[model samples]
Target: MQRFVSERILVQVGLLIVAVALFASTFGQSFSSSDLAQSPMFFPRIILVLWIGLGVISLIQSFKSDEKTRQIASWPRIGIVLVAALIYTNLIGSEGFFIPSVGFAVISLLAFGIRNPILVLLFAVLVPGSLVLLFNHTLGMPLPTSRFSYFF
Candidate 1:
């Protein structure tokens, strides 16, 4: 039992259980009777379904493989990224989404060995700007605005 529990298969099984639980939790969500299309729960449910399917496929693939091959991740690089993310999350509310996200993107790209300044600058600007526009305008979601928002 101990050996089985420690196998790679158990990790896949755990993921499957988590996915199923996430899908199940959304079952109790109530959609609007007037417009099911515009229901708030629609997108989340779709994502949950996709997650569940992926989990099942991964579990099956795990069973098919005889040897468990795990790649060693760069812990220092990962730690730097994690710290950057934490700083971004904390600063976003106070500094607004754009600046903190741009800073995070640049730091992350640099950490991942992206040496080209032009590419990094383009990505750092475009990605966060696009997300800010998408969430704020298209989805009618409000993002944190800086005190100097008027200047931008």
Candidate 2:
């Protein structure tokens, strides 16, 4: 079987390495069983473990994936996404997460060649809307919002 050394594999490897390094760094933190939530390493360790696990799975999948199915990413689309993400970041404080996220989703989807207006509108709204509801309500984690936060 021919091995594929693509960007997908590279990303998985990079993520795995970064996760492992971060996990290792967590060992220096004070671990107190008394208050798991209060421990500095608690969230980091949890996230790192998840990241490492997912990275390994992705790396294995990448290795097993058929080379014929691999689609090369568009450099121009990537640039658009990067620029859109930067704009999204700046818009978060002023325009709020929901607005910026929807806008970003639309732009990114368009950049990646999704031309269906209905699908685009649905995805752009639903994805960010769900996230907003989940974070703002279900998890009790308030995201950045404009003055009329709930209405957004």
Candidate 3:
């Protein structure tokens, strides 16, 4: 099996599993009204249904495609990124989004062999900063904010 086929099947299967789990969880929530329009589960169920549908489509497509794309992920880099992500998740709540995310971005960039200081700093700062702005300010949704980040 080609890497492309394996990766696609794995992703689609994972998506289906997760979507089913989420759909099942929606059943556990208590609804004040049983009405379709008013029930909280209504929107979630719709979204999950769509997600499951997409997963099925992707799975079917995976078998049909014979593209021999040679792109492969580096295990060492992937492991480093996974560890960084785990650490970032742990730090996000306590240390807040900006500080943890900046550190995470820098580590991720470095792990990928991005040694350019200017690009590192630019990406490390811009990505997280834009996310904070998008979530916190633009959308009126608050992400965890560091006390140190007076402006962000």
Model 2: lDDT equals 0.85
Reference-based lDDT, each prediction = 0.83, 0.85, 0.86
lDDT (C-alpha) at residue 127 in model 3 = 94
User: What is the C-alpha lDDT profile of model 1 across 37-129, one tens digit per residue?
Assistant: 676767777888888899888777766656655654887788889999999999988999999999999999998989999999999999989
* Per-residue lDDT of model 2, residues 1-152, tens digit only: 33555666666788899899989998866665637788777887898899999888888877877654456477799899999999999989997888889999999999989999999999999999999899999999988987677563
What does the lDDT read for residue 6 in candidate 2? 64
Better of 2 and 3 by TM-score: 3
lDDT of 3 by residue, 1-152 (tens): 56444766677788899999999999877879979899878888999999999888877777787754466578889899999999999989888998898999999999999999999999999999899889989999999866776773
TM-score of 3: 0.56
Better model by lDDT, 1 or 3? 3
Poorest stretch of ten by lDDT in candidate 2? 1-10
Q: Kindly report which residue stretches of model 1 are placed more than 4 angstroms away from their true locations once superposed.
A: 1-75
Worst 10 residues of 3 by lDDT: 1-10
